[model samples]
Target: MLRPAASSSSGRRRRSARSRHAPPQRSAVVPSGAPRPPQRLPAAADADGADARPAALSVRPPGPCSPRWAGSGRGYANEPRRARPSQRLPPQGGRGPRGWQRACARACARAPCLGQHQPFAACRGRKRKKERERVFSLPAGGRARWLVLPGSEMAGLTAMEKKLAEYKCNTNEAIQLKLVRFPEDLEDDNTTFNPEYSHQVFGDDEVAFGYKGLKILLYYIAGNLSTLFRIEYTSKVNEKFDCVEADDVESKIREIIPPGFCTNTDDFVSLLEKEVNFKPFGMLLHTYSVHNEEAGEDITYQIYKADMTCPGFREYHERLQTFLMWFIETASFIDVDDERWNYFLVFEKYNKDGATLFATVGYMTVYNYYVYPDKTRPRVSQMLILPPFQGEGHGAQLLETVHRYYMSSPTVLDITAEDPSENYIKLRDFVLVKLCQDMLCFSPGNLMQGFSQEMVMEAQQKLKINKQHTRRVYEILRLRATDMGDAEQSRSYRLDVKRRLIGPYKKKQRELAKMRRCLRPEELTNQLNQIDLNMQHEQLEESFQQLVSDYRRVLERLAQA
Candidate 1:
């Protein structure tokens, strides 16, 4: 117990002292006809020397401590007398006298005796000791629980999970498709060459969420009863779908497609050799081969533009987009009937033992938006190069061919892409920079003067480049021309870019000043509505640093080109 031991002599003396200071109690019973002693009251002197009874006797009730008072008296006559408990001892621990320190230490080290009357005091010391030293130390000779540090287990778990059968797909064959709706849409190769456009479209966006695009394609295919599709090429499949069967075409087509796609060439080629030509759609655009000098063999390939007018194009397109749901993260099917949509496809062509063999590679889609009176703006919407064929320069060659096809059109404006990805941006930058280098307007002397109205006008007229893109190109080219070792040249370039970033902040400051004049005095000093000058400076510096870093990368690429 925290209190002193009852067996000790000092404890007895302390208990005796406590008992002497306690209030006396009355007995619950009294003798019936007990004679009461008459109490004499003290007299007090009042005003004018008049004698009066003591205030205590006049106003107070009978005291419980008085020996003459009986239990029948008015004061607490019905109340019962009870024994009082002993004073509680102060809790030990923390900074204290040396004797208390030694006692508390001993109490903490000893285990509790649960059978004791005061369980709280006996167990509380152990709890307090644990709280003071809560380190996770293991006991000696015990079976050690493996304490894995945070983050190491996940990598091992992922590797083990990959070995399970459920982690892999059922088959390795897939059909490659390129869906487009319009002719002019195939102008920009970036739509297909840029890696950013290789996205899966989930049906969450404005136009595609409810399968509207696929519905239109299905409707078109259903109306054309006599049309047949020719599956000119395939990869990783043994079956050949040459002339497709019209009746129950959707189910048959579904059966032909493997559970997964774009990975295994051997399986893909084997699957394509199977004959399932009951219902087919699409036709071959072109077939050719490239001579690989290193291998001294001619590698044949085919390019196809999907004919929307064909009978089964709609069902084929709908099936093709199913691949998007599996492969691309943000791929959504396009509306087949939209006159503005256009499709371009690429396939691998080879001679297997003197027999012509074709396999699917990749494809792209574009949308042609009408410009104001007499022109058209072709935008590349989506592009993909099959995983197996990626890094083989097929994307660049396909994009260039598309660009050349539209370059001859008098009504066609410069090509553009929608929400180009970072990889696409890099590809676009490389292509545009290479094209602009040959033009007189982007010469070294012209770039060193910074961006100008003349340069913008020239790029717009000759290269069909927009003003915003022109400004960016100028910055990139200017950085290329600049000699960073020269202090004056580097400082000039830094200040030039920083000035452009500060333009919006300055304009906003003007608007704020006008607003402050119209607002009431009470609203003017509100911290939330006001802009801090220090914060503005910090933002400008951060923006400039980022811009300079990006420009340096562009400049490095330009030098290599």
Candidate 2:
């Protein structure tokens, strides 16, 4: 069209323009009949010849919907268009807008075209995830969408709840204790029992936080008290969460039970076979018989007094005292090597094939504390009747047997208890009342009079009862003699007990008068306000009623005896 554009130069000019706009060409040869690879376009340049956008946003291959690929016969135009990273809409139910953005960002990172476009497959997956979330989500200010589920769906919800429930366990319920006599007892469901408490082993809450479906079975052979320790659970806390820790129940139990307990069931069962050779430790103190209603026969029991010097007895004792941790509150191990410590053990004497087999029924510990003027006070420390043997009068039998054993010693000034529990006190009341009822000083006629020094002297000299206990015995006997139906006798009895009950109040009144002399007027008034006389009177009456009720039970039992 004009001097006919320089033919060779025209071709060169067009090629130069294509080089500026298109992706770099590969120098490698292509196999014949193979289509060339798709090329991307470079971003337009500014007047200064610098790229218009960052490299990550500049390079973009032709999409399937693009017109440039339609005539290439590649069938790209027939396919669906992929969304650009920035142009994509978040999926309907996805992790909201944020999740879609995250998906898009991840897709872009893995794109062959750098970050220029998100792939179709990745976008589709994100859309499906969003739809799922939307379907499960509750509407704004509406009830939970899952509430109207069918039975099967409800069961699914329960499974979810159960899954969460496994993380927390009531340790008391989770731990099962059994006194295994036969090998079959281990497998019997009837033989299993739970602990009354686990706060001593766990913490105050008594919860094992990091476990699911926890089952800790502790089995001990009925005879010789050999242990079989085992623990089981569906899942542990560490398996689910990285930050939390589960209770180390085995270690806690180990701290209580001595070394040499069997962890294997076979080992424990083998140990039970040797129990026929197990005899009562120490010297035999007494033998008694009890009627077993379940077995329809009489079973003989033996009591033994053991010390650390007895062969194998020290180790046996270590195994025996471990029961205290499970049953006794505020339980602690004692120094068995101490000479003053005395152990009284009870065993069931059973004959198996003409050989006597002794099974542990219970035990009591007494520490002889030195009293002034060469006398010794034997203090009852810990007493426990194995659960299987409890409620069968073994406790009463063991207690009375121990009392008789101490009564013979001249050095024993009196029998006492260290921080006796309510149950022990009740047992002691019954035993002492039974023992004193036969004495002349505790006769009904003498009891009607009042508590006397004669009662104290006779009880101490004959039974080694302490002065405080002797007074308590007097009251119990007095209540027994009093006729509550007669107003005069009832009034007298009430007034008598009230006088003793009011002792602390009287002492407090004296202290208050002394305080008036020293404390300022405001301080004295504050103290007086705290001591409400009306409340004290009401409490006194309540306490007197309680004491009379307790005394009546003892009398009833005494009558039975």
Candidate 3:
């Protein structure tokens, strides 16, 4: 009944449905777009020699003193694009679709200039000129700017986009791509953390592994700048700072990093400076560590055995939990721009089976950015997973994870998705069934027209009537515009036309709520009593409504006369 995905390379359209993973924590950026939440040095780190301790993770907040290149792009560096056609031969023995696409992409295209991106790269400036031909022509090297952010930081992305509200040209807010990082090597317990000797790399937020930790990578891209694209890794959650752990971290670094392999930051930086690298102006590399107290001590993945009850760790833990859960699972992403971000999610497991696109849900402008543009963060558009792990309810779990870290506000989180042809909207319904409390309303659909016959006929008739009405209104307005002397009279005539069109419908609706709620019982005695009450109330209010309606009629009639 099916061909194995591993061997099937028959031009199948492998689509990955968006699978949002749960964030370990939540970061609520209140709408004041307040300056990067002030950084208070961790109290645990306040002890002796704390200032001298290595920074496990550094905060790159938006400030006047922030990194100058934080948001300003370096354009497309010409290394990959500047290659000659001879480079397209792929050293004579390259294989696979990635290799093919790479060669094709690099070869036939008009290369862009190195060092800077074209200023007119799809023109966002207000000084519109008649130069339409240039937009189509690729500046010598055809490559354009690419945004690379971690797949999971949808909240931070959203916060950054809000800050860009005033910038009109930042239309490419949400970018889509299959962000595949296939490092040439890999790292593990047997290996050490050496950035210099690395061949390949795979990174999920701040935590990344180098070529010594070999793994296949294939995924999509969206509107994000993968900034933490490095070998050094960190996963921050709730933890009391520990010098011992830092030392252990350093020791571990000693093993993975072989001698003569780049040992220092400069060596690590060079790994990213390779010719075929996707570099964005900024990157928000976020990884979360939840304190699994119940799991007990001596675990390999454990971050701490210390008390989670401490205010700093516990409070920040809660904040992070909420941020991770809410942003990916529940946060509303409204892509105001036409930017459709590409995405790729590499699961812990890679099945040869294609990604079963379980659902395609969407949220409208139910939410806005809370931060201002000067802060300069990549606006998030999606929180999605990769192709290999699509059907196993991971998407829904991801949504729930987001809800856990949600920042409270009024938002309409709607999902628009399609299921397998045989199981249309089934998975979506399953999620809705589970998230009943949090869900607003959903519209399950099929590729069919469901209009009732009566509605169809009525709509057709209304279309003609609407056309006539529009013509009449436009003509009357045009006449009034041309003849100011009769403007007042024409205005009255306009009002008459409007009332004739909508007055009865409005009046009927106003009467319906009262009529529906004030019903009489069917029992004889009860009916009599209800009728008497209804009669009395109706008598008391009948004249009031009639008089008001009549007064309005008189006013209109008088104006016209």
Q: Write the per-residue lDDT of candidate 1 for residues 1-561, one digit (tens) a residue.
A: 112123466655665777564422322222222222332111221111111111111112223221111111123321222211221111122112222222222221121111111111112232232212111111121111111111332233333222221211111111223222122212333222111221222112111111111211110011111112222211211112111111122343344343333233334333343322223335554555666776799787766666588776665555445445444556667777787887877766544445544445667788988999999877888877765467665765566556655666778777788887776666666556665777788788977777789887776666666777777777777778889889999899888888788998999788778767786777766732568888899999998888778767766765754
* lDDT, each prediction: 0.45, 0.66, 0.25
Model 3 / residue 436 / CA error / Å? 3.0
Report the C-alpha lDDT of model 2 over 1-561, residue by residue, as the tens digit. Answer: 001123366666766889454422211111222232332122221221111111222122332211110111111222212222321222211233332223222222222232223222222222222212111111121111111222332344343334434577888898888877677888998878777767788767677655778887788877777888888888774422212235567888888888988888888888888877777779998888889888899999988898988888888888888778778878889987689999999999777667877788899999999999899999999999988788777888888888888899999999999999988998898899888888999888888888888989899988999998888788998887888899999999889889999999899899998999999999999999999999999999999999888888878877876
**Prediction 1 TM-score vs. true:** 0.48
Candidate 3 accuracy as lDDT: 0.25
**For model 2, where is the 10-residue window of minimal lDDT?**
65-74
lDDT of 2 at 180: 73
As for candidate 2, its clashing pairs are 93-130, 93-134, 94-130
Identify the runs in model 2 with alpha carbons over 4 angstroms from their true place: 1-165, 238-240
Candidate 3 stretches greater than 4 Å from native: 1-381, 387-392, 403-427, 437-561
Evaluate model 2: give its TM-score. 0.71
